[model samples]
Target: MLYQVALPLIPQVGGGTARTLVNYLGTPEAVFSAPKDRLAKIPRIGEVLVRSILANKEAALRQAEEVILRAEKEEVQLLYYTNTAYPDRLRDLPDAPLLLYYKGTANLNAPKVISIVGTRKSTEYGRVVTEQLVQDLVKHNALVVSGLAYGIDIISHRAALKEGLSTIGVMANSLETIYPTVHTRDAERMLQQGGLLSEFPFGTKPDAPRFPSRNRIIAGMADCTIVVESTSKGGSLISADIAHSYDREVMAVPGPITSETSQGCNQLIKSLKAVPYTRAKDLEELLNWDKALAPASLPKPVPALDLSGFPAEQQQVLRVLQQAGPTHIDVLSRHTQFTMGQLSSVLFTLEMSGLVKGMPGKLYGLV
Candidate 1:
């Protein structure tokens, strides 16, 4: 755990590079212990990163130990990316954090997760729309996720609590303190139902640069993200952009054109970048929540596929999906022994043919 948490803190080991190192070396400890010459030979990893790793190995490990201790004292759970408890949706992201410090009762891997973000200077109309949407989400037993800031963030969290739905606040700072101290009490109230989560360790202040990375979690952890209101530029729009880049569903509430806060949503809608969100049911329909709500039953055998004319690679992927039963894309890649690019092409073809279904969080199932 120390190695896992500390390796990413290396000067040159970013989330993407960290994952690459683990993929190549099998573990953080091995990555650190590997010869510099060998490490430098890996694609994209250069001499500078190798030297950085060697030079900072001791300091990074020491910091990791301190952070782990603080987490233990605070009763916070450290979620390593490889852990089963880590959000599967987040794990699929190439830039996912190496570890997350979470202090919440709500399951991070809840069956239904929806992220809500909007302008911090939200107006009453935005608040009312957000409240109604969250209220409607209650019936579907959705877990609401947000940044826990002022305005629409607080509104979404409070609405979720009012509806008895668990809400997660993904913080930009450490779990030790909530930004905008005025919302601290509300954050405490959230602990009764949902919990606070962060990738930053203790003593890390909420600086300007951290929020964009924070927004990625808000966007990545859910099956879809809804922007209640945003201006032409803001963190909410950034979250929507990240979600779209991740291929997650993105929605935006339509607001009056006269309002600046509505411009972001309008632009997103106009550009065909996001679905226009009107109500909770619209979101539910878009996500196919009814299918998710159906009773669980024994896994069925994959239906027969007449792939005589299909390429061997596509046929191989179909057979793997047939046997695996709604497997994650990573697992599909491993089972089929196909590269991500190959797997994506095969899955796209199957989806286009109506032979397979793509679920949120990079899951695929036979149709």
Candidate 2:
């Protein structure tokens, strides 16, 4: 655990690099202990990063120990990328944080997760739409995620709480303090239902640059990201863009063209970057949440598949998909225990064979 926490602290060691080191060297501790010559030989581990690892080993471990102690004192959970508790949605994302500081009881991998994001300067219409959307989502038993900033973010969280739904607030700063201090009380209330999550460790301030990094987490951790309102530019649009890049479902509320706050959403719709969100039903249809939430007894028994002609890997993927209905690639990888490369190859073959179809948000289902 100490080595897991320390690996990310080394400068220039992003999530992808850290994963590569762990994959090649066998473990974080092994990566730290490897000789400089050996480390340099690994792909992409240049002289500078190798030197940084060797020079900062002890300091990084010390910092990691302190971080662990503070996290314990604050009752925050340290979610390493490889930990079982870590979010699977983020597990395969190239830029996902290697470590997260989470304080909450809600399941991070809830079957239905949606992030609602928008401008800090929100209008009454935005608030109403956000609240109504959350309320309607209660029937689907969805978990809500948001940045917990002012305006629509807070409105969504509060609405989720009122609707008896769990809602997670992704933070740009550490768990030690909530930004926009006014939301502190609301955040505290969330600890009982959902909770606050952050990639930043304790004492890390909410600097300007950290918010965009924070936005990626919000985008990566959910199946869909909905922008309720925004101007031509704002953090919410940034979150939407990040979500789109991740191949996650992105939705934008269509507001009046005359309204300044609607410009960003209108532009996204015009560009075909996002679907127009009018109500919760749009989300349900996009994500197939209605079918997912249907009573287990109601599903028709799947007919046995004749997979004899397919390769073993393809057969395995088909069986899982048959049982799981629409599944994300990450989930398929976990169930099949296939590496991404192997899973992609098998899925590609099945797709070309007309046995599988791709769905929104990187999901795959029977054709």
Candidate 3:
């Protein structure tokens, strides 16, 4: 535990470098015990970084011990990346944090996970959408994930609690300090239904640079990311980008074209970078929620066009999905003899028409 926690603290040894070292050396303890000459010869270790690790080894070990003690006192759980209890989705990321300090009852590996993020200065529309989306997710038994910031992040947590769903707040700082300090009460409430999680250890301040790293956990822990509101640029957008890079489902709530907070969502949709999230069922369908759960969450059935009304090409696609059940987009195209781009447009129309649902891993099925 000491070596695992201390490895990432060594100067110049980031998550990626630590992972590389651990991968090559078999363990964090092995990396530290390897001879200086042997460490210097590892692909990217080089002599300078090896010397830095060697020089800081004692101090890092001390820091690690202090963190372990703090965890005991504060009731924090130290989740090593290799631990089975650590979030499985997050472990898939190449640069995933080596250590996480978690305090909460909610399972990090909850079957259904989705992050809702937006601007700290979110507008009323954003709040309403966030609340409704979180409430709707209850039927799917989803765990709402957010950054625990002002506006949409806190709103997401509160809505999840109100709806009796689990929610996780990924913190940029250590468990010892809540940044902005305003959400401390909300964090306390979250412990009942969810919890606050951080990759930083005790005594670590919530600095600006630490946020992007925190954002990854928010992005990586979930199966998808939803940006409720954002300007042209912000941390929420960063989270969306990271989630997309991880090949997770990305959705955006569209706002008025002129609203500053809506620009990011509009851009994401306009560029086809993210799906246009107009209703909660958009998420439900995209995530492939069980058919039985839909009736409980949705107010009404998705309005689907009769098979006779759809163009013959779309009807053909639907017929294939009906017969094949859930099938990959590539398989759909091959069976229907449609080109990839052509099949995509057909599927999009069918999806918007409520006849088809898209699943993760590029699979599609009838709604």
- lDDT (C-alpha, whole model) for all candidates: 0.88, 0.90, 0.86
lDDT of 1 by residue, 18-98 (tens): 989999888889987898888988888888888899899999999999988888888999998988888877886889898
Top-scoring candidate (lDDT): 2
TM value for model 2: 0.93
- Candidate 3: tens digits of C-alpha lDDT, residues 194-291: 99899887778888998998998998898789999999987799998998887678999999998999999999888887898888778777766645
Clash numbers, per candidate: 0, 0, 0
Stretches of candidate 2 off by over 4 Å are 293-303, 337-348, 359-362
Worst 10 residues of 1 by lDDT: 298-307
User: Residue 175 of model 1: what lDDT?
Assistant: 90
Q: Worst 10-residue stretch by lDDT in candidate 3?
A: 297-306
Score every model by TM-score: 0.89, 0.93, 0.81
Candidates 2 and 3, the one with greater TM-score? 2
lDDT score, residue 148, model 2?
88
